[model samples]
Target: MFRDTSHLVVEELSRTLERIDPAQVQAFVDALLAADKVFVVGVGRVLLALQAMTKRFAHLGIAITYVGAITEPAITPKDLLVVGSGSGSSLFPLAIARKAKAIGAKVVHIGSNPQSDMKDVADFMVRIPVRTKLYLDDEIDSRQPMTSLFEQSLLIFGDIVAKMIIDERQLDLKGLWQHHANLE
Candidate 1:
């Protein structure tokens, strides 16, 4: 039963991944590369994923900070904020995205809902078509529980974006190691 469930999860994820548009992802990558400073924000499990991406960005030598970090600087017009919300209606992320836009900072929203109110606040968006609490009407029932698919997809997408930048910048493992924390 465990083997069958694992296979089902993979199958569901494969189908969800197929719906993602590479062009949209490329636009996000281009924005990340162009930004002087990058800020990331999310909530709960989504925040965990963005936090991991923030660490990877640091290792990749891109200036990045998780929103609300003590050392984070004020965002400016030249900065980019990446916000992930599976529902896209989460108040915290939406509020930050709104503030970023008002501050003249570019915002990239990574979520599953195209029609989410957060879409209006974002300057750019990468839609990941997966099941979330708000999107449970999906024809294919997900093996993973509520919003797990979307959260998983967000993590994978973040990794792919980081890899693209690492490759384009010709950053090798040795270079990444240079940025890794010595104490960790």
Candidate 2:
């Protein structure tokens, strides 16, 4: 079972890389650069990815907010909401995406499913091809167990986006490093 699970994970990961569109990523990076503010949110393991983005992005020229211990609020025309949801159909994420749109903010969704509820709301959607929770049996923490590809991918994808943002913005290492915390 362990070996099968390992193979499944690798296969899904390879498919995910293959399916990712560089153009879509560029557009997402462009949007982030243009926005006055950026907000990233996710649930469960996906949130770990968002937290990483929040840290790195805060160093950039733009303002980056995240949903962690508290659900941070960001709703404005110049605001961009970035959501990482492997399911694409989760209520909280979709609802927040809707609210962001209601306030004229642009929405970006990173998920395994392209046809998810949030897809319709997203101005930019980066699809990562991975199995949905339905493929796995119930486990204590998984949303569903045996299917954590999205969670894992979110971590990787967020870093990928961050690099894209850096390049698109033409930010040098020193510029970003300046945003680093002196106290820490």
| Candidate that scores best on lDDT | 1
Question: Candidate 2: lDDT over CA atoms?
Answer: 0.75
Error of 1 at 15 (Å): 2.0
Q: What is candidate 1's lDDT per residue for 1-184, written digit by digit as tens? A: 9999889878887887788888998999899889999999999999999998898888888899999999999999999999999778999999999999999999999987778898788987898878777745643347688888877877777788888888888878776788988996
Local accuracy of candidate 2 as per-residue lDDT tens digits, 103-168: 999999987677668878998798766667644332112222554766776677767777877776
Candidate 1 accuracy as TM-score: 0.93
Root-mean-square deviation of Cα positions for candidate 1 versus the true structure, in angstroms: 1.6
Pairs of residues clashing in candidate 2: none
Against the true structure, candidate 2 reaches a TM-score of: 0.80
The alpha-carbon lDDT assigned to residue 175 of candidate 1 equals: 65
Clashing pairs in 1: none
Give Cα distance to truth, residue 53, candidate 1, Å: 0.9
Candidate 2, residue 179: Cα displacement in angstroms equals 1.6
